[model samples]
Target: MRAEWVLSSLSQALLCVDGEGTINYLNAAAEQLLNCDHHTVLGLPLESALPLRSDKGEALKPALLNELASAGGEVKLRTSGIDGREAVMSLKVEVVRGDGGEPAGFVLLLASHATASSAAAEVINHLDPLTSLMGRREFERRIDNLVNDAATSSRSHALLYIDIDQFKLINDTSGHGAGDNLIKAVGECLSAELFAGDLLYRLGGDEFGVLLCNVDSFEAKATATRLVRAVKRMDFVWSNISHRVSISVGVVLIDQYTLERQAVMSQADVAMYTAKENGRGRVHLYDVHDKNLSRLHDEMDWVHRINQALSKNEFCLVNEGIVPLGDNARADACRHSELLVRMCYKGELLSPGQFMPAAERFGLMPQIDRWVVQAVFDYLIANPQLRAGEVMFSVNISGQSLCQESFLEFVYRNLRRGNVDPSLICFEITETVAITNFSVVTRFMERVHELGGLFALDDFGTGMSSFGYLQELAVDFVKIDGLFVHDIDKNPIHEAMVRSINDISHVLGKKTIAEFVESQVVHDKLAAMGVDFSQGYLHGRPVALIHGAGQ
Candidate 1:
């Protein structure tokens, strides 16, 4: 008893067991380490303390007693106790040789550390320690391995890349602890569903990946369905707050005959982006036939070029002429043209088509808008003879800029500094942009109106659905979209759209201008429609700012 007590006090874990592998004694250190009192664990059988094996009572690994009897000095093996929580144990077993020089029973003195060394840490680092699931690195590594294996074996594997929908919003509203719990729940649910060969990985922050080896197309699809269903059924709870999480999955089967494993993975990535584009919570297979990826690459490149253009001041605005509603009505009156905006880039004047959509996507619309405003002001300041009343300059505003109070403030300060008469400026905002944020639009329009400014809803007839929203916004003027005016000469529908819009504007007590009036016939057709004003190449093309018509 004294020897047992002394040995138990000297080590982290010390236990005595009979030849039948039943634990008879456990000392103070073992109880303290395992978070149990000695009295509770003392007489518990070894298998009962750590029930890792099934009910059949089979040991997960060979019994430590058999090994200790053979090698009496130091024996190293892994074992777990107190509900299968792991520990690394180095056992120094004392084999009491009987008078016959045969081993009696071994007294095992054990010391342990729960932590692992750096080498083991690196391996498990690719696995989430809490759930023992693959991480991003492990996911990728396994995928790579499977790809190589398939190449040699002439088999195929599939990768399912998944993104949790609206996870950021949830994470922000809930605490990070909740986010962590949610992720752990997902990992657990996925682990429960996938078989031994399939691997689930959390690829950091609401994105996960799975590598399914030896899975064909049908099996891959079925696995994706299983994963989606698993995620759907899981109600992640943290702090008693529960929420459902859904996922969008993109799958790519390795084409070992044609592409490398990395390429196959990249194809899946592109497909994942497509799934996101088509709205979330659906699975999409990688379609190699689609050229959308090429277009996306080009668009990204174009976005970068546009940003560079803005930085280098490589873009300029051209002023198109906007005449009065009745300027050409009398047929002989002095026709004063209102200034319209066009853009010049790389020493060539480009229409709005060249960059507007790309600009909107890259969030460069506000900067482009600011540049337009500044350009008009700079031109007016430079050409002193072009007085405030000489011509009204129409500058376009982007929806993105309108949503920003900082942009509004900046516009106000710049306009005030330039001392440009606000009334001489006709600010053109698209109906689409104005209707979406009515409150901001109302406040901005009111502020600009107080400054003696005028606002025109450009592209008006395009969203004919917004008549009620238009009345609610109540701006100074409406410029019909060029689509209706461009084909008025040929398309009777276009003619009717213009006529209806013009009449509606007149009824609302607001003015309407016909855009894209490229010919006298179209201009005359609009005039007959009672369109207030006409603007296009017919009046004049956008030109560089001139003092007096390039004199």
Candidate 2:
């Protein structure tokens, strides 16, 4: 297509300018927009042809024209119409790249009031009067567009939910005028920090939204932190009373995982709430793995279902056998199995991976732990032969349950009631759990050991203080983390890590159990490394201890 044909086809006014800001060409729409003859304005500078000013009536600076020529973005300004009346115009500036991809000149596209006055008015109506920033409605509109763009182009954006801390106190103590001034000052300060493509919006009274274009989690977090620090340093003087303000920011990354605009806002809101809950004047990034935020709407639903299941005894117990790897007769004589809990909801079996995270996050793990203990005891009482034999069941306990004062008492009570042998039970605690509630877990392990029950450190290699905790806590076995055991036969680093963990555990006189042992090669490797036990799909999947009861 011819350049002139394309320029004339555009309905918006188009002007071609040289590097010196001298106008060289004006399309038909541009001549009609300026209401001037094309020959008369061809050689004139942009400032001479069109008198431009800011919304506040300040003359447009020469520096801004230079910035516009190189900015490659759109900016809004007011210019005089043919009748000397003020007209709002949106100017999109683009660099005209030469054959060598160097900046040759510039093309300025002007969408004027004559062409889009109604649309411009609609946008202006959505601007906050005090801050002159886009309001919540426009924010929502932009978010929707960003969401659609992300879906189509695989682009990423970030949404920051910023809330001024103690803003209500400021408004209540000082007058409304002072509060308005503070808000305007904050808006200006934040706007100054924004880049060309970034957007700032006044979501509501004390809340604002920042739309960061094409940023990842790290960039978004850094920007949010900067915003928080900026707000913290802002000093507002009202009625001769000096006041300092801070902000709590919640950041959500917008990408393919984002379901919709509301989802994005909801995630950001949840993150903001987390920041407030943790402490004011901080930034929190939304974690997709966080159960509380992931199922925010269905939290109460899960709570109710879990409560119902606990009351009605709808939870089931399963077990997977752990086989001894070496030729240790003692290890082979004592049959070991890991106890897993599952839920039966509406006749469907649910794995612990689905509900245990929520159970732990909401402080319901103690109750669930008690239920699992009672269920295991009942199973032992029913199958007296297994309990009387050399079989020992390893029950997994959550960190929350371990810290509770009543959990240990509850376990003792169950043991006494069922008259079950403590020697047949072994409790498993993760390495992280042992390190987090160190004192309580140590006491719990001592109490269990005193009662002839053993303890195993689960996911041993995942925590930073794994070896240190193994030395501190008196665990009889260390279950190597599955991440180090999943493909040990194929990955040298994983094999070396597993070997190091095994050697360390042996040095501490604790047996090592390597989980995720999927292949014969892995099993043989673990045996050769002197690992005590191996557990994974190669052994057996978890099955109901009481056949047909859980299913």
Candidate 3:
């Protein structure tokens, strides 16, 4: 009667299994949870009613009772219920000894921990508080288990690392509250689109990760494309302002070929960044076609050579002319070649594109920038005629080096030490990196402006733009992006955008520069459209105005 009453009072479904895993008793809650009566459950094998299996499917050993007696603790057993619902049951098997202290049938209390919360909800709720999606801790734990299981079971899995495009722009303009709302909306969309077996994880701030088990590349890529399309269709409207959002995804298939979890993740990241470089708002798959890998290899090789060149002072400056506005409204007011820097590698001259990206990756850009300035100053000291009157030289400033305040101070110090006029040197910053850290960029521009230095916004109209931010940058020169200027005579839209930018810049007291002007037809069209200055094959190819020693 005591046992019967004890069975009647349990809140969780309780089950007592014999040493052979045959059901001996069923509590009232257990009957309700499994939708079966005591008569039906009792004397039946546990696995007949539940899909519960151990690391090995052999009936849970009688050793459980011995171990529980020694440990005095509970163990968790997970299985599916009679209705095929996933369930978690805690098992505590206590030793029941006979009068002689020999082991008899043990008492087992199996508590169902699987009420109300579905497996999906349970998984989602355990994520990080901020993102309301799988936290990094949970992600690592799950991946670790997957890897461990794969080692023995020979299963396969894949992970997709997704990054949102122009996320910072939203955070900056609309405030972080809007940003948080957008992130949640994206998470909800992902959750709805994924199937039951797949898991979508929010990997912190505008980045999400997915874990797919037993999925091949073809299916994985198809799913990824669907996700990308789903996201592409999503429009976020905040305070009556609507904006379209998109993502770049990098999918990595995990199998015997994948060395480790970190390596898999790194490959996905590389692929994601590759997508970014290709273009935003598109999906780029990881393949052997990406020349970046070979380029990266060459870049590493170039890094050593660049370092050696820098140490040996094997860099030189060759000025490219920036023509001033003239009286004819079409000719230059005496064009002068601004000192541009170059480095020699293995007896061959390497331009900025060949080595700048690698230099920035390896933390050598600032040193390279300073070396260029010093090299130009040395050239100016040697050529007094070039320095006479209002001479100006244009120097390319890297986005990475510009972010470092110390680098700016170094440039200022060098200019003063070289006795070169700050007004005579123009600093060129590409449009993409200028808007990266908007507030920091504005402050930097103001500092340089105070010293009578000039600023040129290079590659304008190339990056995704918010005209509001553009107006705020207030640069002195607007260098039209090559895409807009390239074949402008053929593309009316390109011509229109260039003309619009030119009009906007001129009205704001900023001069316009058209780069990549290839033909006389392009030059004539730009001049007719009132372009202030043009630079390209039509004007001149980038050539050395001054050469020596290594020449």
Candidate 4:
């Protein structure tokens, strides 16, 4: 009775048959697998519940079952499915002896062909030919099981996504044969370092997945770090040329909160990409509270929101005036106001701080930039007096939008359609954006200048190559970074830095605008440094382009 109870609890299907080949009992697994009720099948012929056939596709006779009980050996049989399909199942038959040492009954242990192939395959499936580790299919199956178990019970696990860094360079410089050898070597090395309950899977070329059971965030992070170091230390030699290999690992904790297998794996993949982006050969933990990940999730939500906003015209344009500082004739001639964008949500005005980060991260900036430009152009056309006043509206453009060929065409088309003078509009590109895409930005600036539009390198002195690229980019204005101007009056170092930037801008024949000028002291200091313009709360806050524009 105890043995029968144990069999009933087994995940694999089990059955007890009498000496006459009549079914006596069926476990829960057997009932589910065969799609029959145990009470209904009891005392029935074994063949009635599961129509078993020999491996050769012939029906198994009673004599064969009796012989198998007598000999006590396993047999492979084919079972008929509900849809008339055949599925291979393995039957390990054990004979039960009576007191007189005669055959009494048989205990059958049943399993699917894939799970019963070999001892190793029982734990996994379809081991990789080269690495001898479990393949992608088995990995996915195990992850599904983990997810299901987590839904029922409280347990924690962690998944590590490992990707070889600069793997393509090795393949391109050497050959495919070398790449194959390196893969095998790395797989072997990693497999050797795994713990007892851990599993390593080769998830296709140059990528692997490690399922670490019963581990928390700290342990998982430590394991990931060790794995990274181990990969970096691997001595890979191909064709007498030594190759160094490193891996980026993304770690994500799995628990009841984990939505599903696909979502968990996607989280790991995102963390891995973050590691690669932050300079490879590192481990990144998937923190729900992380600003970037939070922004990422918010970005996905905002993608739809932004599209809806554009269609429904939920966006508003505002402007902040840039006041002249010092006795500069050019500053007096240039009437500048920076155009800012805001979104209307739930009957309240949402500043750029709330949604622009999401837009930038999710590549929705181009669409938003186009909307801003079109709206600005429309406003200028409606208020011809503003255009005739020679007011230069410095509209900020995203780096992504500025890099696209279509954006330039869009700008030109809108200018022509609005019949607005290009000189009255100045596009603002950040210093970092200008420096990162120097050549592209240079060409863009030249084209804009040809169209009579001016360019301003915004947030100056923030990028590493700001000074170098400043000489290359053709712009009319340079806005000093707010960080330098925020406390320039109190901090001598900041004051000196602002002075240096101001002097350099004058040398380059560009007008300087000091940002974050919140007081008369900061504004006066900038004026003392010959800064051409000042913008902040001290000058004026951003107001709607058209008055009485409320959400």
RMSD of each candidate?
A: 15.0, 16.9, 15.0, 9.5
- In order, candidate lDDTs are 0.69, 0.81, 0.72, 0.81
Q: Going through the candidates in order, what is the number of backbone clashes in each? A: 3, 0, 0, 0
lDDT of 2 by residue, 1-551 (tens): 34654454344688887766678887766766667777787878767675766555655344555576666666777877767777787777777778998766677777774556477677789989889999999799778766755664456889999988778678867968888888898898889887766799999898999998777899999999998888778888998999988888999998877879988887787788678767899999999888866655355357668999999989988889898986863546777889899999989989887777667655689999989888877777676677534788899888877766668788876765647788788889999988999999888777777778888999988898777767999999899999999888899999999999999999999988988888899999898988889999898788888742421
Considering lDDT, which of the candidate structures 2 and 3 is the better prediction for this target?
A: 2
Clashing pairs in 1: 320-340, 322-338, 325-532
* Colliding residue pairs in candidate 2: none
User: For candidate 1, lDDT tens digit of each residue in 393-474?
Assistant: 6777888899767789988886667467787687878988887777898898888888888888989866646687877776
> In candidate 2, which residue ranges exceed 4 Å CA deviation?
1-295, 329-331, 416-418, 547-551
Please identify model 3 stretches exceeding 4 Å from their true place: 1-296, 324-334, 387-389, 545-551
Residue ranges of candidate 1 with Cα displaced over 4 Å: 1-149, 167-206, 236-244, 273-279, 289-429, 432-454, 464-466, 487-500, 503-509, 524-532, 539-551
Across residues 1-551, which tens digit of lDDT does each residue of candidate 4 receive?
Answer: 24553454345778888888788887766876677777788988776666888787765445676666667656788988889998988877777779999888777788777767774645544688778888898888778766654564466778999998888678767988888888888888788778866789999999999988666899999999998988889999998999989999999998889889988877887798788879999999999888887655555566668778888999998889888877863537657788899998888888998888868865689999999998888777776666534578889989989777788789977766648888889899999888878888888788778878888889998899778878878999999999999998789998888899889988999989888889998988888788998999997789888833311
Instruction: Pick the winner on TM-score between candidates 1 and 2.
Output: 1
The segments of candidate 4 whose C-alpha lies over 4 angstroms from its true place after superposition are: 1-146, 153-270, 281-316, 325-335, 342-389, 398-420, 461-472, 483-508, 521-530, 545-551
Best by TM-score: 1
Candidates in order, TM-scores: namely: 0.55, 0.49, 0.46, 0.53
Model 3, residue 172: displacement in angstroms? Answer: 25
Q: Give the TM-score of candidate 3.
A: 0.46
